[model samples]
Every structure is written in structure tokens, then in C-alpha cells.
Target: MEDMSRLDNACHRPLRSAAALGLVAVLTAGCTGTDADTTTAAVGRAAVETSPLPTVPPAQPASQLTRAEVETAVSRLDGVVRDAMRRTGVPGVAVGVVHDDKVLYLKGFGVRTAGTKDRIGVDTVFQLASVSKPLASTVVAAAVGEKTVAWDDPVIKHSAGFTLKDPWVTRHVTLADLFSHRSGLPDHAGDLLEDLGYDRSYILDHLRYQPLAPFRAHYAYTNFGLTEAAVAVARAAGTSWEKLSAEKLYRPLGMDSTSSSFADYDKAADKASLHVKTGNTWRAEHVRDADAQSPAGGASSTVRDMTKWLRLQLGNGTFEGRKLIDADALEQTHLPHIVSEPPHAPAGRAGFYGLGWNVSYDDQGRLKLGHSGAFALGAATNVTLLPSEKLGIVVLTNGEPIGVPEAIATTFLDTAQTGGPTVDWLTFLGPIIKQAAEGERSPVDYSKPPASPAPAKATSVYTGTYANDYFGPMTVSAKGGELTMQLGPKKQRFLLRHYDGDTFSYRTTGENAVGLSGVTFTVGSGGRADKVRVESLDTTGLGTFRRNG
Candidate 1:
């Protein structure tokens, strides 16, 4: 599954809390085959149970492929990737295919950056984004294999600092729950904290103030929850998450090009430059430091290294005849722990969430386990394995909001199944992308104007420092008849233009500005605004900030 945390809306707008939820709702509405329904389970939690996993018919054994057959089946993939790049304007991509536990094809196409001659290679490192989840889960699986931690153990047992708003949830949430994304927090619940320059530890500490859904009631994909789980695993293993992942998975599999640290990415000789499309041009993007949330989506790797990782996954924790983890422990990560509410597209027979993978049966009744990673407006990645066929494919691209990786994955899987490329993936996906972009740009009225016009307050009354427990300080300053609000650590300043009453439309300035949103100030006694509320796609609600000075 794509990391909802980083995915923008169909219109390519800056993703806020509401837009993120709305996008999920729109995309997943077809997944459930019905309206959004919430059910109260016998366990006293409200859960949304949608389509259940389809029962797999008796397995069909896959045929062994000769080297020639594999070659013939994959000969068209290069053309496919090249055509996709031409269609989507993606700068560079690395493709890898593993069949029957052997790397059949691993190559790179296009240049590392637009208008640059430097080519992406098999070892060109790119941020794995949410794809880091499975790797982190594998490390935890290794810890489980060592008897250092049990999957069902409460997170508090390992990390005493772990907590949530509800005492019961804090006591009951387990490592398994965290991996499966069932911690009750909404999707990307603590992302604002990260946006405010808070580290993982601070984010975890502030989780006690975030609202909860239902404990074990819904599948909310939360990067913060996963980060906490990784911390718990690290604590149990007596090592940091990065160190544990390296020792347990990367080193064991000889994935020398992979590292969970951005520092390592910076030091790498060959790295794919991040890119985003702006006005029909693919522009390089600044690298984001994600080391603070490394456990959730902070790994950099290459197609060469990813193929090895895929081989291990297809081998059920074994790589090169070495059993790095117990087969049963590895299998547990693939088992469905939570039923995802909105079905992801190209709907499989049944969609479910495993520890670090999306477990579902393809339309052909083959078990398809995979995950897609998206670096915020930089890179896109996909890794898929069909254990029944001993087939896996990895596609990595340097582009924002593009479906090329997914298109490539699906086309490759289809080719493997039919012995030929039966799908024009670009042709099929182009319209969908266009339609999403159009739909996202459609205007929506979110304003509820006051019944009557109120007197305008003095500009000085609205200027002050407002504080949020999790997001830190926001200062509204007025000078020369203009008002601006500066966010905490990032100090992102947005120009505020009065709209109606105390509400003002704000547009971010500078190169990193996301987009326009609205903010409302609530005036109290003494004609001074005591509270401010912001409306944006990234926030779940108003995100009230109180006047502290």
C-alpha cells in the first residue's frame, strides 16, 4: 500500500489532515463495495469491516522457467519502462525482476535528474519511503526469532515511555497491533508534530494528547504508531532501530547498498535525485531529512539491494540457503492481522494488512504480497512478491505523484502470469491519473459564513504567539498593514488576508510553500484574540492554537 502519510490528493494539492482522509475515502469507496459503515463488535469497539479475503482455490503449482523463457518474457519490460517515463515524465527508474529465486533482470533507465547526463544505475540509492516498513518488520521478526521479543508483547513492556490518550489502549497495544496499523489513531495522526520539527520521541510523548478512534477497532495507517513499534523492538533487542535493521537484515542478506540513515544517503556516491513536476517540467527537489522517523519510512536502497530483499521475502526469511529467521516467524508477518477498510485499487480478491505488507489474492487467486513507498514529492517505489510463483518485481522512480512504479509492477506481474505482456500499463493508467488530477482541482465550499457581519478588530489585537502542545508555537505578526503567521521550528511564514469576520485566507510564501488555506481567530475579552484555528488538508480538525503571549 502507498504511504497515505505522504500521498497528496488527486489534484496534487498539499496534503493536510482532511484532504488526506478525503482522498482515502474517495479512493477506497469502491473497495468496500458499499457506503462507509461502522460496526460495533462484540469487543465493544467500533470497527469498519469491509470486504473479507476471498478463499483461495486449490493452489496451482507454478511451472519452472528456463533461462531463455525468462529472458523472452522480460525482453519487453525495458520498452515498457521507457514508454512509461515518456508518458509520465519521470526522470529515472530502476527495475528488478526475480523469478524462481534468481535475479532475472536488474537495470536502470533514464538519468538521475532531468536534463542531467548522469544515469541511474542498479546501485543508485533512492529513499524507500514507506517501503521501509517491511524491512523494519523483518528486523522485528529477527528479534522475535532470537526470543528477545514476542509479537504479542505489550509495547510498554519494551518501551516504558510508550503511551496513548486512553490508558486502556496504552496498556493493551502490542507490537503486532503497531505493525498492523490498528492503534486507533487516525491515519498520519501525529504527522503535524513531524511537520513542526518534532522528533520521533517527542511525537510519541505527545500521542497522549491526540484523539483516538477505537482501540483495535479500525485499521488506521499511522507512521507514528509504526515508529513507536520500531522503538519498542529496538529496546527489546538492546540496539537502535537503524543498527538492528542493519545487523539483522541488510548485512545478513549482503544488501550493502542499503542503509536506514539519511547520513548514509548523503555519503553515497550514487543517489537518485528527488524530483517533482512543476508546470510540465520535472524539477529536482531538496532532500528531506527523515532520520527522525527512520523506523516508519526512512531507508535508502537500490534495485540491486532490493532484489536481494525480495529474494529473502520470497524465501520466507531465508537468503542464499541461510535461514536468517525462523520460517514460522516470517510467515506470521504475512498473515492478515487487520482488514483494511477502503480497498486499494486494482482490487484483489481480498485485501488485508499484514505486519508490513498488503496481503491479498490477485484476481487469478494467487497470493500477492506487496507495498508501495512514496517519498514526499520526491520518489516512488514498489516491491511485490508472488510466493506461489516464486516471482517478485521491484520498481523505483524519481518523481512525484506518478503511478509509473505501480503500472510497471502490475504489467510485469501480468506478463509473468500470461507468458507475455498483455497490458499497456501506461495507456490504462494515464486516464486515471488525469481524472484524479482534475477531480482534485475541483473547488469545494468549506466556509460557513457568520449570520451577520461583525466589526473588524484592530490588527494589533490579533498579533501574538499562539501555542499548541504538539505543534509548538505559532506567531502572528502585523506590520505595515499586513499580517503574517510564522510556524514554530520551520518558521514557515504565510501571508494572512482577511476574508470574512475573524477568518483570514492564508497563503504560504517562499519556495517550500505548500498552498493556500484558511485561519480563524476567536476574540475573547479585552478585544484580543485568545485562540486561532487553521483549516488545511493536512489537519484533522481546526487545529486550535491558544494565545500564550
Candidate 2:
């Protein structure tokens, strides 16, 4: 309800060929319960890269269909992609749909490179982007399986040197709080890894030297904390996060093509190209390998490998015969641990956070376990399953805007569950949004205790382009007693009104800037804003932007 326009979908795609596939397995349409037995589905054809799929005879009365019907379904999906791409500026997208145990459809639309005509294939390896979050969750679960750590372990316990600006809060911060984004940090607007590409040690060094918010007060997604958590997991297990991921996840599930870095895919013969949105179009970009924070958003893979991951999640933390992790750990990871504001709540009653995933209840009150991730040029990738519906969906795309991935992924799930009656994706989402709309809450009246505005002062101490390895360069300008910030193309202005000691907010914006508002002016012995720390609304990735100009 709070200006949904800011959260609009940002990209689009095209369509490809279709093929006939063979039936591999059969499943009955019924709500799955604990008593329900797991069923196996078959491997269709070699692998259809394009859609307008050749239909195989239905294995169940519910799925029985003529080739034409299957083609029609695939064709409809093609329109969905074409329209989505055109509307959202998505350069390339690869989609995989699974019904029951079978991957009923897989297709790529557009091209690996926008103008090169390198047609995307089902096996195209797009950076899973933030899709790495769920995978990270899996790694944590594996650590639990190996008895490497506990969910409730305080994060400070794992890394003795880790601390927040507030000493007491640092000791209380838990691993669950970090991964779940309940660490009270705001989403650092720019890419932490992208900007802070200084070195692998930069994150730790920054944490040791920087100040952080209280451990748990609000929900702000922090990739930095998560990356640290990943490092902690690695250190605890005496292995790198990537190796642990491969051993505990990829190897067990036979996702040989999947990896925690782009280098891994580069060594392989087949992988999709990376692209970025430019002036309403997707342009080719060099694939990046994340040496630092590999667990945050560095995993890359094809639809084929991802499907195996889906199967593992559907099987409740197991694949084939291996109990990769305790089934209870899966439940624990999915259990909502914190309450948050409406629509974006943590995990229970409404929105909530699981250990490393976002757990939401469907209209039917059944649990839908999933998380969404976004990185430069890619976004909103997710794998979601309704254990009750026995359905799962994986949506991956090449361009990053907003909501595009969620729209497609959620649409697929809606279609799969409804058995495809052809509902407009946007129209279908309307009711869900309406249901989620809390109408605006009344504005807070702070008259009882009038807030004291920060003293107006200019510290010409540092004002220049500050560059970090992950976030690139941030330009700061001080003029007319106002400070302005420029990151890439986006710009924001702030008025340094006082709060507590050194914090301030936008001149006019109120609580809307809570997590984002507090801009702290670091003082030197002379009492000047020598090193200013720019705090945003929520500390997801970027907690405090330090002044180095």
C-alpha cells in the first residue's frame, strides 16, 4: 500500500521453439500430507531448449493432453515471456517449470547477448544472482548436518572479533538474526561486493572498524553480515564456503554443472552469457567471478542443475537416498523467527524470516517456503514449493529491474496449482496485493517529545569520490548546507539534522527514512565531520557508507 509503484516490475523477454516430449512419470492430483508417499517422474526428451513444446500423452487424467494442447501451453508461456521482456526490458531469461516430479517444460527466450542472436538454451547458465541466498541457507543447513554449528549460535561466538558499534548488542546477535535480515541493518543500496572489491579481507576489516546498528530492532537485509556468516560457516567447518557447498549440496544432488563462482562455469564449455539493462535494452557484460562473499550472491548454474535443487527442496532436504541434512533442520530454517512490518514481515502470521529463507503462508494457510535474490544485471531469482500442493517453480533471468522474476515465478506457481485456466498474471496478482495492502498507517505524531534537529554545520573535511572494491565509486557533494549522494545514476539528498549524537535524516522525509535516515558525521579530535557515515533506511548490504573522499 506504501507506493507500490516504487516496486514495479522492471524487465522483459522473447520466445523460442517447442518440441514433443515423452512421459517419464505420473502423479495424482491431491493435497500432499505426511502420509503421502513420494512419487518419481521420468526424464522427458534429451532436453528441449525452446518451447511450443511437443506434447507427450498425459501420464495422469489430470495431465493427459494432446501435443497441440502442450504446444498451446508452451506457446502461451512464450507470449508471457515476450510480453514480459518487452515491458520490463529483460534481455534474456531461462525458465523451467516442474509439475509433480517431472520437468514438464524448459525453454530459453531472447539471446545470450541481446543483439548477437546467440539463442539462449535450456542449459544456459545465468548467474543465479541473489538466488544464492537459498543456496546459502542450504549450506548452513549442511553445517548443521555435519554438526559444524547450531542455528541459535550467536554470530559473535563464531567470529570472536565480530562486533557491532554497540558492545552489548554485538554479544547478543545470533546467526539466525544475520541470515534472516533481522539484524536491524538496512539494504545497503549499492552492491557491497561490487563496491568493496578491495579484497577478501575487506568485509572483516570494515566490520572491525565500522559501527553497526543494534543486533535486532528492525528487519534490514545485510549481505555483508551474510557474507560474514558464510565465512564463519567456512571457518567453523574448516573449509571454504564454495567447497562446503559443493560437498554438501551440489555433489549430493548431482548438480555437477552448478558452482559458487563464475570461474567454475568459465572452465566449463557451456554457460550463458551475462547482460545488463541499458536504456531499455539488455547489453552483454563480462561474467564476474566472486572471490569474496561467494556465499552471498555468487552461484551460477543452468536450469538442468537447478531442477535437481528443486527436487531436493521438494524432497524436504534430501535427494535420492542421502539425508543431506536433518529434515528437522529444514523445518527450522523455514520456521519464522521474527515479526516485522506488514507485507514484508519476517515469517509467521504474515511475512516472516526463516533461518535463511522468507517463509510466507499462502491464502490456504499452507506454508510456501522461498526467498528472492537480486544482483547487478540479474534479479528476483527463486525456487518456491508448496509442500501441500506438491508443486515447485524456478525462475531465472538475465536482466535486473524489480519484481519481474517474482511475477513470472509466482505466475507459474499460480498456473501450476490452478491447472492452467489462463489467468492474466497481473490480474491474478491484484487480489494478492489487495489482500496484502494495509491501507496506509496513520502518520506518527512526535509532538509529545519534539525531536531536536542536528546542528547545521559544514565539515569541508572530506568531499570527493570514495571508491570501494564492491560498491564502486560513490560521489559526494556538499553545497548550500546540504549533502548530496550519487551512486551510479541514482541520487539522494539529505539534511544533516541531529539525532542521538551524530545521526541525521532528510530535511523533509519523516519515519519513511528510519533505517535509511541516520547519516552519521564522524568527528575528529577537533570535533569536525572528518569521516561521515551515510546510513540508509535499511542495512541489508550497505550498513554505513564511510567518508573517504
Top TM-score prediction, candidate number = 1
Candidate 1: pairs in clash: 16-537, 16-538, 17-537, 17-538, 17-539
Local lDDT at 459 for model 2: 36
Candidate 1 per-residue lDDT over residues 330-427, each given as its tens digit: 77787777766344456422346778766655444455667766654577777777777687888888876456776777666555545665546556
For candidate 2, lDDT tens digit of each residue in 1-549? 011111111000000000000000000012211000000001111111222111231121222233344344444676667776777666677777654556767887777666776777877776775567678888788787668887667777778777654554566666766776555443431223334244556555455433344335445445566777777777788888888889888888888788986688677655566665666666666455555556766788887788877767777777766677777666567665543323323431234555655555543445666554444333335566565544566767765434455556555554444445344543433233222221222133222223655454553543555654334456667776556655532333344443444544443221111222345556677645555554431233443445563
Model 1 spans > 4 angstroms off? 1-70, 342-348, 421-423, 430-456, 508-514
What RMSD value applies to candidate 1?
A: 5.5
Supply the global lDDT for candidate 1.
0.69
TM-scores, one per candidate: 0.85, 0.65
Candidate RMSDs in order: 5.5, 13.5
